[model samples]
Target: MAAVEECVVVIDGANVACQKDGKVHIPKLAAAIKYFRSLELAAGRYPVNCVAFAPNFWLNVKPSPGSAGPKENGTMETDDWALLNQLVHQDHVILTPSQAHDDFYVIDYAVKYNGFIVTNDMFRDHVSNKRIFHGKRLTSNWVRSHCIDFTFVGTEFMPNPRTMERVVHFQPSATSAVTTSSLHDSNDNDVEAESDDVQEDGMVVDHKGTKRSKTIDLSEVTYYKVPRELLPMLHGEGGETMGKFQEYTGTYIVLPSHAASAAPSTSNVLTLSIYGPEPSRLQAVGHLDAFLVQMQQQYAYQHQQQYMASQVHQAGMYPHQHQPSTGTQDDQMMEIDPY
Candidate 1:
């Protein structure tokens, strides 16, 4: 039987190729993502399947065949360079560059836009980390927050970020009130969900019994149903729809994606929570841009080893051998290993 495909897998390339056991091989993680993605490659699906992000340094640094750290080489020929070139040619397994620590961009992309991530880093040390989960239960206040399932490819178990009973909110169906009940019970809350105005009979309708909008609040977690053309490859039993996330007992299949109210198109998205509400699907990713600025401040640069490097053993540390800084320019990424 052929292996089934799953959701998009975003990678922190440096995080995956950590040198913990000995000298870690750079291509091992690249091959893993490529192997899984190849199992489901097709049109629409796997078009840009496994997206990997690494610091630009990896493009030039040469790795000794058996050593852990990257060394400077006059020639650009090495296993690391070859793997990156292969990823570029394949196109499906795309490799991108991060302005700073690749981990932050990885976190932002996976949480805000894509639904699945593959890295051992859990960034709890950064103040920015609080913005995503904030110690909340891994259920959907919107869909299921803190519900990102992590896989180290060879880890023994999965993640459940908190102790609270997980809450799951399914996509409100067009015929929601009637069908799929045999599938499972809906969330038992008296306050009708703001997303879908549920009638006393659990029928979805507007106050006038006319308009049927499914747009969700910015504060809520919900899923746009996977497109009809993309569903088969994305939600197969063996796919990564649930990925490493532990399934709460009440729910089974991930309900399909569908058209929501005229909210912004998710072409290029931004994820944020503010004192006031401002949402834009096409907003330039200024948070990371701002973060990069903060990291480059004079005080931050000289004192970075004292402040940031102290976080090496903290959660969300970068998973690679440390590169000794030569203070070349404004392109240094946080490198440490704890998560």
Candidate 2:
């Protein structure tokens, strides 16, 4: 027999969404699973030798009576979100959490056999540079390194998309009320209204727009507004105020937290260094198939050798011992003598 290349698809049961808005959506979930299975078939037909499913702990839980929700059943929620959160903090192979129960057991078996992980959650933040595919397309680098591919064909949720906007802040003094009559008279007089644009500091209003050119102590400012998208990436101008902008903003930013660990390996680095290089999908598939075939052959050969050895030993030791002699009884008795 040939050695089988192992592959495991880790399903995030929590995200499976058997129900939505208090209504059963069984057909949707089933359709999603069917689509995922199709992708698995494609993988197996090419680079993958064998495929297994990694079920999450939540799948074992039954719905509770009334509004109590899913029964605890002594199992922890080993869903994709929780698993990814835990994996980010680990270095190498670590035992799945106890709450995982059977889910952990199954995952352990797959990892032990060098099976690849198939998950949709961006759990590979710690290893972001790894390559991960969504179905047939390369979706993320994180998945590529730690596992094989991430199939997005069945996902129900897409990460929230962000939009950018401009925000303006007013100084405390600028907020003071200005009489409407005084503003009208100033415009009517057109006496080159004292330019609001101050040479160095303070509030300044220009015909183009009211431009505030003064630098006020940040401590004096009561409130400020900043674009939501820019808020995450902003750093203070001076060393003293660095990261201060984020402190004032309630929202947290998502940045590459594991760039160092996810750095490409020597082989990957070499591959990338080549300029104007085009990736060859066929070549990659061929290489993977060759490896899988070699492993299968080695395993088969070892099994055959062990079986032959056992057969030879059994044949040599058993039949002769059971043989009965026709005239040997008298001869054997005659040979018996005191030493």
Return the top candidate by TM-score. Answer: 1
Candidate 1 per-residue lDDT, tens place, 1-339, comes to: 111232344666666665574333456656656544553433434332456666554554444442344343212236656766677666634444312335545655544442345555444222111223222211122222322333344632233334111212212231123222211123322123323233322433333311121121223222222223333333336655432221211111232222111112333221222111233211212332443354345334556656565756553476565566686434444452212
Q: Which stretches of candidate 2 lie over 4 Å from their true place?
A: 1-7, 17-29, 39-98, 101-116, 124-142, 145-339
The digit string of per-residue lDDT tens for model 2 on 204-271 reads: 32423211111111111112222222221223244223223222331112221122123222221101
TM-score list, all predictions: 0.35, 0.23
lDDT of 2 at 292: 40
The local distance difference test score of model 2 is 0.29
In model 1, the runs with Cα more than 4 Å from the true position are: 1-6, 21-24, 39-48, 62-77, 92-98, 126-129, 132-339
Q: In model 2, how large is the Cα lDDT of residue 322?
A: 48
Task: Tell me how far candidate 2 lies from the true structure as C-alpha RMSD in angstroms.
Answer: 28.6
